[model samples]
Target: MLELQDAFARKFHYLRLSVTDVCNFRCQYCLPDGYRPDGRKSFLTLDEIRHITRAFAAMGTNKVRITGGEPSMRRDFTDIIEAVASTPGIRKVATTTNGYRMAERVADWRSAGLDAINVSLDSLDPRMFHQITGQNRFHEVMAGIDAAFTAGFEQVKVNTVLMRGLNDGELGEFLAWIKSSPIQLRFIELMQTGEMDELFERHHVRGAAIKEKLLEAGWQQRVRAHNDGPAEVFWHADYVGEIGLIMPYAQDFCASCNRLRVSALGKLHLCLFGEYGVDLRDLLQSPGQQAALQRRLREALADKKATHFLHQGHSGMTPHLASIGG
Candidate 1:
């Protein structure tokens, strides 16, 4: 099988495929105003998704993370999971969600072949969670976590966007909670997009501080897997859970780039902060376009920059994270 290698020899093995761009939550950092239709209502069909997954799998991609404004918002989310998981060469099927429907649907999702799950739980405090996500479903989301474990997931990952005055002071609380739960609490640094400049300035917290605290507390950093996401995982001897730091602003953050993103609209994003995308929907119209789609993917990869210039303040065509399933 051909590998999706960039100019720097970074072989891409993971694909972040967005099943839909619509989400129900009104998260402050992402879609504070809530999701407004951009006139493009329908996303790629199930058949289109299947074709893309097969092409990527043929190119040595094994992991597919279904993201969105919130992936489970789609009615056929379980079917989507089944489609990707059944694809040959695909070893893992995961999704990142806000956990709204997780309590009721995760068991079904697990049955449909989803093995890994990541939930966005910004704050343990209900009030704080409501303040951050603009949703009062804090208790419901927590229930979803419990449901995930009951549904056979040994470890559940919780994504917490690190913000200065928001949930920054709750690290101790998070650590305490993780001490007894099999959770991987991930601290993601706040990133600046085309919009949310004010929010970004007010809340953006450096991930290095979290790393320092973890190291001082005797948490050892673990080696990354060949197809792992961009999180520096750390383990503690006394804790039942682990901590992962996703510091995108770090100088060497993109050094181990191994994933590619495809939007719900069927456009290929070489980088999260990339300026534009290569349209793959036209090729996705039929299954016979597989060879062309693979060739196009390879050709487009040659244009991928060695690293994203996000630190230079170039967000590049990305109005927000939800638009491309960040």
Candidate 2:
């Protein structure tokens, strides 16, 4: 079987496929004003996505994460989920969403074989959520959270981007909320990606500081034998769930990177902060081209950058996160 190995000898097992570059909420750090997509097809059809997944699964990929401006925005989102989940050799399939419309489909998604769900919820307060997301649907998102838990989905994570002078003041609230819930809360360092150059400088919060606050508040670090990704997870003695800090900019883990991103346009992105990728969409459009697609995938994987420029000097406004399925 084919296996994707980078120059650093890291094995790749995770793939994030962005089905759409359009989103409902306009989060400041993600899609600010003047942001535009590459004008590719609105999304990859179910068969196209399945073909791509089959190709990747042939190469030892066991995990697939469906990402989007919002995956639920698609009318046939559950069909996409089922197709991926049923792919051979794929052990798990998940999604990341804003959760504005997630409440209505929790049961459907779970039945469709969604292994997990990550919700982008920077602030719990209605005003703060609206100001940050350009939407007044905090209640709806909150309802979605409730519905997710109620639907019997075992793993639901909340991704909170740490932004100073924005939602930073809600750390205590976030911690308290997660303490009593089954959902894991992951605090992400505000990254200077997409149209977030100014926002990163103005609101970036060090991950160490967030960890310090958590430690001070009695959250103890649990040394795990294995970690899912970049996030360093922690937990309080009494809590059943975990709190994670994802500091890609502060801590360089590129040597151990095991994931690649497929954009809505069908380009394979090697790194989040990378400026280049291999176009797999056109390659897969023609029948009997799986061999060529696999060759291109291997070529791109072999040359994957050892590390991102964001960890070196300045992380100045990288590619749009929506397109890359952040």
lDDT of 1 by residue, 1-326 (tens): 78999999999999999988898888888899999987846698999999999999999999999999889988899999999999999999999999999999999999999989999999999999999999999999999999999999999999999788988999999999999899999999999999988999888998998899889989999999989999999999999999999999988988899999999999999999999999999999888999999999999999999888888888889998999999
Best by TM-score: 1
Q: Number of the top candidate by lDDT? A: 1
Clashing pairs in 2: none
Candidates' TM-scores? 0.99, 0.93
Please give, for residues 195-225, the per-residue lDDT of candidate 2 as tens digits: 5667788998999987887788788876633
TM-score: model 1 vs. ground truth: 0.99
Cα-based lDDT for every prediction? 0.94, 0.82
Candidate 1 ranges beyond 4 A from true positions: none
